[model samples]
Target: MRRTTTVWMTGGLGLIAAGVLGMLRDNLVGSAGAPVIAAAAEILAAAALLLFAIGTSRESSVVARRPLGVIALVVLALWPFATQFIGRLLSPSEPIGDLAWSVFGVASVLVPAAAGFIAAVQIARADTVPSPWNRAPLWVFGLHVVAWVVPQLLFAAVGADDIQGLAGLFLTLGKLAYLAGTLGLGIVAVLLANRRRTTTVPVFQSASTDRD
Candidate 1:
């Protein structure tokens, strides 16, 4: 396989592993090794995001040609660290920290959602990837929105009684959606990598034939 293809496959696997580890960490909270699992998940997710950014930027897809799409991918890749690590470390009671947390919280939701929407639209319009695979980004965006909104709606509807159980159930569902979305992204990346390899072979052969 080509080096590019290997990168895509490795990144895809990393995403899958990160999702699995994240779920495991959630389930194992307060357990002996929960912190370790959480750290592993965070590291894997960051690595996967970087790899994906590299893969998308190098690929010949229509999305890669669009400046907005590239910017969105880069922003999405970096936003997690800001929200997950740096923001979390800040004390919410302090003025500067409070402002930072507010910015992080809003940006965490809006920025990613906007970025995903932009990327999804570009992916949907692109003909480089095959039918459903091309629409994978759209699904990721849609599911992500659902994951964020549904839990809140459920909480609003059900009220505070039995909050723990209801919250846990919806949160798990949200996590499942997130997992599915990540899995979809991984599949799409692999598909795109294969598609790139397949398309390039014909051009090379055609070039060789013309010289013969």
Candidate 2:
């Protein structure tokens, strides 16, 4: 396999592993090692994001050519670490710290959401990637944002206190959707790598000698 393909595959698998770790952490909540598991999940996620960002930038000049897009991808990749740093620096129990964290938390979501959206659009526009598959980023990131925002909007509109059970249901559904979207991104990455491998032809191979 080509070096680029290997990078893509490794990054994709890393994302899948991170998602599984996240699931495990969620299930192990309240257990003795839950904090450890959660920390592992975050670390794995950050590394995976960095790898994926590198792979994407390598694959498409569109992403690499634009400074803003590249910056967004780097920011997205570093988000997990940023969150961890903020958590350590600020005590959530204090009112000022809590407010600071609240603002940062919102930025954590919004900034990444915006970055992902920009990356997805750029990837979709790049001719280097195949049609339809190029659009996979949109499905992965767009669904995530939709899943996150819809429930909050609905809960606010209906008044969370008025329908607590409904609110819980919405929250649960949103989490499930988010999980699905996360897994979907990994799957899409693997598929894209496979597609590239199957479609690519080595420059050294002549047309007559090249096998289908």
In model 1, state the lDDT of residue 86: 69
Off by over 4 Å in 1: 1-4, 56-62, 93-100, 191-212
1-212, model 1: which lDDT tens digit per residue? Answer: 36566677777788778788888888899999998998887777667766655554445433545666656666766766667676558897787886887777787779878977887787677544467776877877777777788778877877788556776777777886778756657666767677767977898899999999
Worst 10 residues of 2 by lDDT: 56-65
Scanning candidate 1 in windows of ten residues, the lowest lDDT window is: 56-65
Give lDDT tens digits, candidate 2, residues 96-144: 9868988988898788888888877876776645677668777777667
How many clashes does each candidate structure show, in the order listed? 0, 0
Q: Candidate 1 at residue 67, lDDT?
A: 64
All candidates: TM-score: 0.75, 0.78
- Candidate 2 residues lying further than 4 Å off, grouped into runs, are 60-65, 91-99, 200-212
Which pairs in model 1 have colliding backbones? none
